[model samples]
Target: MDVSGAGGLTDDRVLLGRTSTAERVADILRTRIAEGYFPPGARLSEESIGGALGVSRNTLREAFRLLTHERLLVHELNRGVFVRVLAVGDVDDIYRTRRLVECAVVRGLGQPPFAVDGLAAAVAEGEAAARADDWTGVSTANIHFHRELVALAGSARTDELMRGVLAELRLAFHVVDDPHALHEPYLRRNREILDALRAGERASAERLLARYLDDSRTRVAAAYAQAVDDPAGSAG
Candidate 1:
């Protein structure tokens, strides 16, 4: 409850409508988790959120169950649901998945003149966020960049899978003590990857993405472990 808890509910209301269903509620909550509106360990108050979204308690509960299954939320007996704080191993697994999916997406490009406009746009988004000193926005932009990168595969199934995986990754990001350290270093690298894709250098783009995922996995996993192990830290 020390985190935003239910206090962000008023602002969150506009995200949903009176016609909201469980999946829609789940999607909104997932986006909030990724955006850090509900940071790691923040207790979710059912009354607040349900009232804000104009959804029934059952629908809200269903959405909570969905995110719980995704490893993005947890329900404790006698205590309300809370945003999940990922373990260090979870961090490693996330990056490993990213490397596998994202790199493969790039490697599968059979020839040149790939449609990389989305990637370029995402890169520009990150650059603009960086210029505005919006670190969280940079992180969001990075998410967009990766989403665009994976979109090149033209697989709806892969897109949904990566969306869940990336949302889980953002849970780990919330546990990180320094957002800038977690995201700033990746902006130029995103542009580099975009450039490679633009030039039709599939292999080059794949390698760059692989290395980027490796470095990020190392940094985030270590920081996350430290945050979890240190009693004074707010890992969850």
Candidate 2:
């Protein structure tokens, strides 16, 4: 696939900086993975990607190795590299982590010294996407919403962790039968949570977020189960 237009890393200028060129390439690929440009199980064509990104074969290999270590990509002996497909357990684990972290963020939101600007902005973006009938855009904006939710904690470590969690969530989202069905209902819920947070209704917001995640977890897990059972019948 042509990733030159996606992944926020389209610049082809020679990579030269403190970090190795391979690491820079890996970052680009990671962004692509998170953005859903390269869906789960999509094969990475070294020649196409390397040439498109203006990188050498050696650098691409190194970048692939990095993503493999991050569990975003896998390498088979003769099959080359493909995006890692999450198992049902992986889906459950991701939600479990989110419940612990995100709910806590909402619980703490009403406390003094917090920022809801990011969260509000994410909601606006999602609403705009929904208005435009862009399911993918809604999905992207939803991911940003949760990422910003975690940022309310003002912890660098937590923000970094959510980045990985959100990326893995994208992998599972690719299997859902109806992106609109799965996401449209939740847009209103997101707005409700934001409103509660703004009103200092911490308890209400936390409850809303818990229910929201539980429903989403069930939906995505069920869809992933169906996809794993019959890949040919799965949705994209």
Candidate 3:
């Protein structure tokens, strides 16, 4: 997957002209981290990774910095960068914030006249990914669908915060052994919520969304607890 030399570039330059090595490295590493290739509490060694990825230490360091800022990786003084460890409080905070933002969006569902097609498309993508057994893709699509759901409220700040919240929640998904079990059931529920919205059943949609979030929070928390107690049994 290294594209640095694919385009007949001279040793002095990289492919695509403008994409820096650091940026490319960051994207590759981020995708792997999100896909659960790097488990929580796992230590990342710069030199070894650089060698494996065919990059220099400098480029890898820059990539690490990007992930650290995204809160996907944490740097411990002198101990090196490790994937973040999520506590029970992290789970609570993530779900609490999601409920507040998502429910608010639900309450404002029909008042301002919002676009629901984007959410519908995202849900379709999630369904496809689920069918293909691409759990990471399913998680990514699901997050985007819900973010679109929150966008119905018409608040830019809420949108930004919800993205961060979802990113943190994805960490929990990595903790669970079966990503499908955690998210597959919700695909139909999401469709139901959207149906309520399309039918102008605002109150019903709100209620459905609330219950959906509650069930999701419980599943994620239980998975996290199981992972913590039996790390070997959990997914990456």
Best by TM-score: 1
- In angstroms, the error of model 2 at 148 is 0.8
TM-score of each: 0.90, 0.85, 0.72
Model 1 agreement with the true structure over 157-199: per-residue lDDT tens digits: 9988888898899888767677787788899999999888788
Which of the predicted structures, 2 or 3, would earn the higher TM-score when compared with the native? 2
lDDT of 2 by residue, 1-236 (tens): 22324333445334534444897788678767877888888888887787667778999999999888878888989878888888889999999999999998777664743567888999999999999999888999999999888998879888877887888889888876678877898899999988988877788888999999999888878877887888788543
Off by over 4 Å in 3: 1-39, 42-71, 110-113, 234-236
Candidate no. 3 TM-score = 0.72
Best by lDDT: 1
TM-score of 2: 0.85
lDDT scores in order: 0.85, 0.82, 0.74
In candidate 1, stretches whose alpha carbon ends up further than 4 angstroms from where it belongs are 2-19, 231-236
Residue 42 shift from truth in candidate 2, angstroms: 1.0
> lDDT, candidate 2, residue 15?
50
